[model samples]
Target: MPHLVILYTSQLDGETDMSALCRHLADTMLTLRDEAGKAVFPTGGVRVLAYPAAHGATTDGSGDHAFCYLNLRMARGRSADVHRRTGEALVAAARAHFAPLLAGRAIGLTLQVDEGAEVFDGKFGNLHPLFTPP
Candidate 1:
């Protein structure tokens, strides 16, 4: 499973479309593949979530300063190269998505990929079954 969480300043709610960005990121994630050309992330297990921070400060808290941080968490079975590719792809997609805003406002965009030991994982949902081959 690949989960992408996007946190951005609330002011952006009036400037751009967060829902569109989420779909863009999710679509980008679906394009990832391993070196052997196998799909990297299962379509059913991919999720993109975005939250607007009601309060935030960037740099000196001056001059239309805004920020967006994207965190991608995945299972710990992928190779280092795959992890690297995932991060790079997400960042590239985000930058492209925010181009219009970045040109008009001082926005900081950051993306990171995290893969840590899962002490306990419990998943309950019917979404996965919808993507299974008949």
Candidate 2:
């Protein structure tokens, strides 16, 4: 399972479409596949969400700056290379999404991939069946 959380300053709300950006991210992740060309991430397990920070300040408490932080949380089982590739793909997508805003102002963009605990408890629906063929 992979869950993406995007946190951006409210200042960029006018310039950036958070909802669209989230969708783009989700779509990008779905494209990732292993060496064999099999999908690495399940379609049903992909989740993208965005949050606008009402009050945030950059270094030196400068309100003029804007920031976007993307965090991808997933179960721990993939290799370092996989993680790196995923992060790169995500950052590239994000950069493209915010290219316009980047040209106009100082926007700090960062991506982080977090590996969850090895063992955890969870529940799910029959969504996986949709991805599986008979």
Alpha-carbon lDDT, every model? 0.90, 0.88
RMSD in Å for model 1: 1.0
How does candidate 2 fare on TM-score?
0.90
For each candidate, give its TM-score against the true structure. 0.95, 0.90
TM-score of 1: 0.95
Off by over 4 Å in 2: none
Clash counts for the predictions, in order: 0, 0
In angstroms, the error of model 1 at 3 is 0.7
Q: Of the candidates shown, which would achieve the greatest lDDT relative to the real structure? A: 1
lDDT of 2 by residue, 29-100 (tens): 999986678787999889999999978778787558888999999887787888899999999999999998
